[model samples]
Target: MQKLYSQGSRLDVSMPVIMGIVNTTPDSFSDGGDFFSTKHACDHADKLINAGAGIIDIGGESTRPGAALVTEEQELARVIPVIEYVSRHHDVWISIDTSKPAVMAAAIAAGAHMINDVRALTEPGALAMAAQLQVPVCLMHMQGQPQNMQANPEYENIIHDILTFFKARIAACIAAGISFDNLVLDPGFGFGKTLTHNYQILAQLAQFAVLDRPLLIGLSRKSMIGQLLNRDVEERLIGSVSAALIACQHGANIIRVHDVAETMDMLKVWQMTQTQMIKQN
Candidate 1:
């Protein structure tokens, strides 16, 4: 069994887990316009909790390719209330998905348990805020900003680039007084990689375990699956599940996903079969 993940609160990372995505955005490529209202967001959070989500990651901004950036005030307006509502109502762990330090601090003040920063806390002064808050933080690796990330994806060595990025970010977090166990790594599946780069990253995930941090793979209904199967966002459940299963098999500790029920069912069945297979072996 692996060790535990203390993202905000302590998570028994003895086994693979699923973290459900609750997008408060109006333009996310997947599950956008789905959980936009307070009532709807709260309802969706309940559904995800019932579906076996170990954590609920709420995001206000859309980091989708070429997605417009939301101002700090706008982002706070969008996510703080939702985080507050969930924190006040639910006993489940809450993850705030934001890159801005202002929003991160505000969310932390609102009782968010984790900070899932797409920039890996490289944004100046962000690491300090997270350290000050003393919360678990997820550092995601993206080649560039969201506005022009997909314009031209080029990399001499994708694995090397990702590792270097993680190393720098992890070092910064450590220097900022954040505990090592409280830090998580995200490969940024669809942040800025090409279709080929995305597949390559997913296929060779073991390379990332060198960083020795809990790995998070958020490929739920991402463009890589959409391109692979030529399916729309609504039609990519199986592909997303398959991708998540592959990621877990290749050493991913957590999977951030929109399709919580299906992913949870798959995880239950997969775990049971793994137990049987291990016994037979």
Candidate 2:
């Protein structure tokens, strides 16, 4: 259960790791267009590291609701250069937020350390490629594609259904050659969940512990925070960090966020409290 993601050469996650979000696309829900340029993307990544992000999650595609798809060439064009640039320069762990096997392969060839596939390697040949590449893969549970997943999102039983999906995927990965140690799971908040379902999963997040894999929660400045606080993406930092703290307190091993410094600061305070409780105990 102890494995490092390629993003930071992070061989450990017994404590939480702050994964900084770097969207090279022009349309991500948060921090889009801010680092569309390669230099800007690398600069922002360095900033995140200085702010306490252990991993730099770079994505070229926009998975936000109703966002049109970018062609593979466009996607590759957007992400590969950034990946190559950072791989050569930074000592940080580099994760390519891609679903295409071709892109994943190319990114790996270019020196990407982890494959954070939103599709959970469900894309054709993606699982096999990841298995062959033998990198840590984070399986995300998305109810439907980004196109219309939110249209009528319904879960027979949110937690059970997500666990079932993860179980099957984990089996397939093992069958293909990925080890449990190299696997992580994310419930794909806001990817398809209703606001109610989102909180329900968070409330029951610890249930995933039974699977015995590292848990990754990405509630950073998402719609869940926005809808909960009636705030926009630009103003959801407090709610976002609060949700991250709750997830970490429960059982999350990793938090993917847009605000790395703030999350780390909050985690420091949280660590102090936990230490006090332990001493008192």
Candidate 2 residue-wise lDDT at 74: 91
> Candidate 1: lDDT of 80?
84
lDDT of 1 by residue, 109-218 (tens): 88788899898888888888888877888899998889889988899999899899889888888888988878889999988899999999999999988887888889
The candidate maximizing TM-score is 2
lDDT of 2 by residue, 36-144 (tens): 9988987888888889887788899999988788888998988888888777877777788989888888888888888888899899999889988888889999988
lDDT of each: 0.86, 0.88
State the weakest 10-residue window (summed lDDT) of model 1. Answer: 1-10
TM per prediction: 0.95, 0.96
Candidate 1 regions with alpha-carbon error over 4 angstroms: 1-8
Off by over 4 Å in 2: 5-10
Model 2 clashing residue pairs (backbone)? 4-10, 7-93, 7-94, 8-93
